[model samples]
Target: MFKAYRFVFIAIIACFALTQCTSVPKRTQTPQERPDVQQQTLDLEDAKSSADWLEEAWQAPNDIAKNSALVQAALTLQDEKEWQKSAAILARLDKNQLTNDANRYFRLAKGRWYAHNQQWPQVYKTLEGLPEQFTQKEYKRLTLELLAFAAGERHQYWQALAWQVEAQRYSDEPSPNALWQTASQVTQSQLPAERPRDLVLAGWWRLIDNHHQAMTSPSAFSALLDNWQNSFPNHPARERVNSWVSSDSQSNEVDKSTNTIIAVLLPLSGQYEAQGLAVRDGIIAKVSETKSYELVFIDTHQLSFEEQQSKLEELKPAGVIGPLLKGSVTEWVRQTSLNTPQVFLNQIDADTSEATANSHSIFFALNPETEAEQASEFMSSASSRTKRPLVLAANTPGSQRMVERYKESWSGINEPSVSLFSQRDDMKSAVEASLGLVGSKERIRAVKIAAGKIIVDEQERSRRDISGIYLPGNLQQVRLLKPFIDVSISPFAERIPVYGTSSAHELTNQLGDNDLNGLIFSETPWLVQNGGQNVLLNQWLDARSGWELSQARLAAMGYDSVDLLQRLPIMQRMPGTHWKGLSGVLSVENQVVNRQLQWAAFKNGSITVLEEQPNAGKNNR
Candidate 1:
């Protein structure tokens, strides 16, 4: 649920887990521009780290101080990424033997641990027992924030906001920073739970961060503020925004080095010439001939892969961006020596890539593999008792590739039991055979054979093991498959949900409405029915004619590619940072720019927002 801010969320939890933890990674800030997180950093740095605390607890003679030391030691251990060590220390504590602060501290520490492991129910139970008020004001505020975070993970945004509001007031930190921190903690799925409140908070963050933009485009900023204030008559952050504006005109630049030219390699001629042109246009739309960045485009059309590499060196650009084909991406990764930092616009096949081991190259793509990965994450994280997902897809080369990629991504992130099946010509037999479900005609004959002795009717079992189905197929196949899946799965089981992809468009085609109901999938924001829209984006799309709209995905891939150049420096500095961009919530890990997508489902006639609004409460001004 806390997708965009994964590393941030966990680090924040670790920051306060131990009174004695010293290595907790908090956001560093100058005192003049510091957020509420500064206080935690100051306090933690003054205390001993987990190792010191653990040793002190082992040596301390007094029982009261001993328990106190133990609690601190456990939390400190957690902050240091030593989960087993923390758990071992926790096992030594006897809650009944502790009193006052020690007892409360233990519960809070455990609550943090639950959050670390995503044990949401345990997080709530452990934290709910604390007193309504605390003797230490800072601890009280921290506790409330943790509660809000836990609630968010549980898809309880309303409750999260309640806690966040209280926490914000109680916090001895700047109002704007407190507000931003709280909003960041709210899970994406639960964003719309308090729409106006979230809008105001998000607007303030954008206002503060885009100080240069606000100064340059005062009218646009003012109109944005007016809309926000008018929409929520009494938002708490509305007044805070007025103070956020600064007269300073200097821009916030993401400085890398003196190297300024960026070489872009794409198919300027050949079969993919059209796609390359679209991407080029999108990049051009975002970037101007600014003093900061110079751009050069190299045609990958007539050149061999080695020649393309030679051309890249000739330009000697600061960073390279392009080569929209997957084959180029794979070769780029396998190169033993890379001269400059180059970003590939496509993802390589997993069988060929060891991206984690690669260097000086980045891969970003609107790949179906990424969509399949997100589907697996959504099914696992969504708060259902169901743990088994029967992944069924059409038995085609592309579908099979997507399925493997899905399994790879899913297996890497979660531990849920998953089964795979494929359908070709016969949907019914395929569905039944996949689940190992019994066929009636054969069973009837078996019953007839056993008539004299005994007949085991077996009650026509439904494999209760299957919680959902993943069908990555087109509309025709999906329409044919859904009814068969419904009949083949046992009636005793919960309604088996099917997760699909953009391959299955919810819009009415030859296969008409509502047939493939309850199919969930991730698509580009603009493609989805209830996606958070941007007027600027719409206008940009309208400006282009012919096939740009039809090839929107490839175009966006180009658009976001250029935008990523500036953000990469910031992301490199802060590993977990994310920002709202054209594609989706964009974040970088291991030099690869990842687009965290929005989820939707097919209902009555069209696809609607199923979980979170990816761009809702986002900064569009």
Candidate 2:
């Protein structure tokens, strides 16, 4: 209903502005010799005075500047904050007669008045005209500043920043450095050592902004809050974070030892039922051999918050996984205590205070931040050996973030690395440019010869030193890049080893036999065999009747997640060490989960293990 009202309000404003007006004429100077120039000048002054008088009169509209007076006179009533009278007068204005500058000034004035009244939509509408008609720097600066303030009031920080930056760029006046210094000093002033909700909110806001800037992960932000809690133990936010951490720790212990009741809370009867079933199967298969587990399923389809709470209370499971939709998670978190450990299949909305409070209890299914960190660590280590690590990424937003993370991680290690970029349309050219073979027939001929003398010579030169290439793109995009790699090392495919992520699993399917030969990179445990001795896991895989792709990895993660529960203390102590799990080696540090990536090279149309050791290096290239 609120959404509908907002739409209706927008439509009404659109109609009022667009239908009641015609374009104003461009401003032009009136000649002194023109006919009726004297009369026109006198009338203009009279109009201006009347407008000002009406504005003043509107302060007490009942006493003066009544409806029967001139339209300009009625508009003057607005100066007294008589908005209704001002609107009526503005409706009667001859837009065609008003000079462009006057029209703009009037609109800006109206916008400021609306903003002052907290009429955000109206303010937005009125300010829209000022941009097109006003050229004065002062007016532009004022309008932008006011608009930015209005946007900030509306909690539209990004939009506010855009206008604020524009205003600052145009304003020629010197900055108020003294005022800023005074404010900074005030902010730094010591206060009574009491926890304030406002302070917590401010800290959260700063953390969120930093997260957006790619300065830290969500977990890092949570950890910061955790530290704050330690300082002010009684603070509500602090209590919440502590409770969450405690709950997760408790749940992990329960899942490991006793015949644990693991509840799957998801929209099982509705849209995501199939996915829920898949997850259920994965969990079931993982715990089939263990006598210490039980799977309890709860359908979240169309359930209200109260119903969800009741259902969860009734189940009383050791751990809960899901409530897949973000909205459901928010509702559930708001009404329930963080007693049971929870694993969120997706990120909970950061706006929900309850969700943030209970974040310690929840673990995201796919943490891009963790993935980026691990990838960087791996690349850094590989780069140390190769001397030159080349980072390549597509022009997409996701790929760009991945590349930025890689660069950041690389920067932290104080390592030298080169970044390469390829656009979807210019992949061929970008690849050639990166290889430093941009515009030469010799290079072109060398790539074309499959096993010829030229190709062999080029291959030998390339093999003298092995260079690591990091490609952050989808499997399909990576596959397109493979042709370039093949071309670059046509004669020496065996000699030049290529490295990539687990995403390369898909690309492996796309390659021809032996095309990816000598390709080596880290992947999850399920993708490789660490001595190949999981008889039960193999039996389960063979007996399962669905897709055979990466199911093994999921099964391994499930098994590992459950198995690691009992060994949490030991795991936490040596987080960098390898844990022989179904997926690969599992590692955890500071509560951040890291996988001991299994490196493999393409061999005989399958991946062959190259290295199964934990990534021991300090730098992830």
Q: Could you tell me every candidate's TM-score relative to the true structure? A: 0.55, 0.48
Clashes of each: 1, 13
Superposed model 2: Cα runs more than 4 Å off? 1-259, 267-274, 301-306, 323-335, 345-364, 384-386, 411-425, 439-466, 489-496, 507-513, 530-552, 564-579, 587-592, 612-621
- Each model's lDDT comes to 0.61, 0.51
Q: Candidate 1 on 349-455: residue-level lDDT in tens?
A: 66433754544466788777778877766665542443456777766787878778766655222244433445456677667765666565467567878785675
Candidate 1 clashes: the total is: 1
Question: Which pairs of residues collide in model 1?
Answer: 462-490
lDDT of 2 by residue, 558-610 (tens): 55555444344333333223356655555544333455566665667666676
